[model samples]
Target: MPNYSEKPTIIFDMDGTLLDLAYDDFIWNELLPIRYAEQHQCSLEQSKQTLFSFYQQHNHTLKWYSSRFWTSQVGVDVLAMQIEQKAKVAKREGCIELLTYLKENGYPIWLATNADYAGLQFKLEETGLRDFFDVIVSSETLGHAKEFIEFWQILASKHPFDAKNCYFIDDTEKVLNGAKLFGIEQLYSIQQPSSAKAPRETCNYPMLSALTDLIPILEAQTTEQAEEQKKYA
Candidate 1:
């Protein structure tokens, strides 16, 4: 029942929405801890536990996504690790097709993410998805993570899209909840963010197994609009 012909603003979360989240999981859960262990001469398990605890303290805040902050605290180059793992970066199933469809239909596409600029750049370059976005907003630039209401307020001040006429897709429930709080009417969650992992338990919001699944509805809406326009003309 969604109407793409309304030319609604479409906001996509970078990781887990358009791109497979396995790269990020490996980086945070595996790679970063490994590097942290080596840097501090600690056991891997102990390093992971310590790093996770440290991260949780800043979770859902700007510092959660800030590479500079993490670098200063952890004494490891987060950007370097992201670049080294660039080979693992990949588009999610139907990501390109969905983006291409939206682009061709003239729907405004925005990439809004909690990723820092460095992390966003790494993924963009690796996946070659930069050209698909009209604007890319990062938590680092906004000084607030997507989970914060202030982030959406600032985003509206800058981009000025109608929340009710927008479609937002993200993997994180917290971010979706934030958008909902900001009055966005259409919110979707990705069922499976990491291809390597099984689908997570159902969430409160509607779930998308693949973005292309919405293509038919979008196409139908566009066709209906065209026909109505023709009749009026």
Candidate 2:
């Protein structure tokens, strides 16, 4: 395992980028509503209405990604529920293939996820994605969601990296916009984040249909860099 630290750093989002968003979709969208109804002794419809309203109110905010925050607001231990369904957690298509390629080739890998620390911990533990990353951060730890430039600011402070020389891949458009604002040179989004959902038709940044789709992009960058070096020589 020779790691080429000089290569352009690659930052990834956890749930929706490297890992299947289907597990999260099942946890939040399908399972939580039923559990909320059971806990509150209400109809499933009522539970969904209440929860969906909360989602709309806080979507893309730091609170939106916190299991503890939801637990306190909804009277459900959301973290525990997610842990219970850890069996549903899975890696997205080509996730391991792409990561293995990067790791073997020496690209420094980092994970910047909006998932709270608890969620990040469990998912990484279950998926064994922790070892692949040199850096792992949770928005709950940063005090700002990835949708804000401040999050990138704080992250850069803690771990110095060249934003202009790095690539970031995430499923969320707002997160990509934040990284772009912070001067990240290359940003990408997933075409289909969740296995249970349809592929996204468009994104502001280039969309990766499969995780391995990034291989040729990186290879081409290396090729161009070599050609420039030869020209200078």
Question: Pick by TM-score: which candidate is best?
Answer: 2
The collision pairs in model 1 are none
TM-score (all chains, Cα) for each model: 0.91, 0.96
Model 1 alpha-carbon drift over 4 Å, by segment: 1-6, 220-233
Q: Residue 13's C-alpha lDDT in candidate 1?
A: 95
In lDDT terms, which candidate is top?
2
Residues 13-118, candidate 2: write the lDDT tens digits.
Answer: 9988998889888988889999999999999999999999999999999999988899999999999999999999999999999999999999999999999998
Alpha carbon deviation, residue 157, candidate 1 (Å): 1.0
Which residue runs does candidate 2 get wrong by more than 4 Å? 1-5
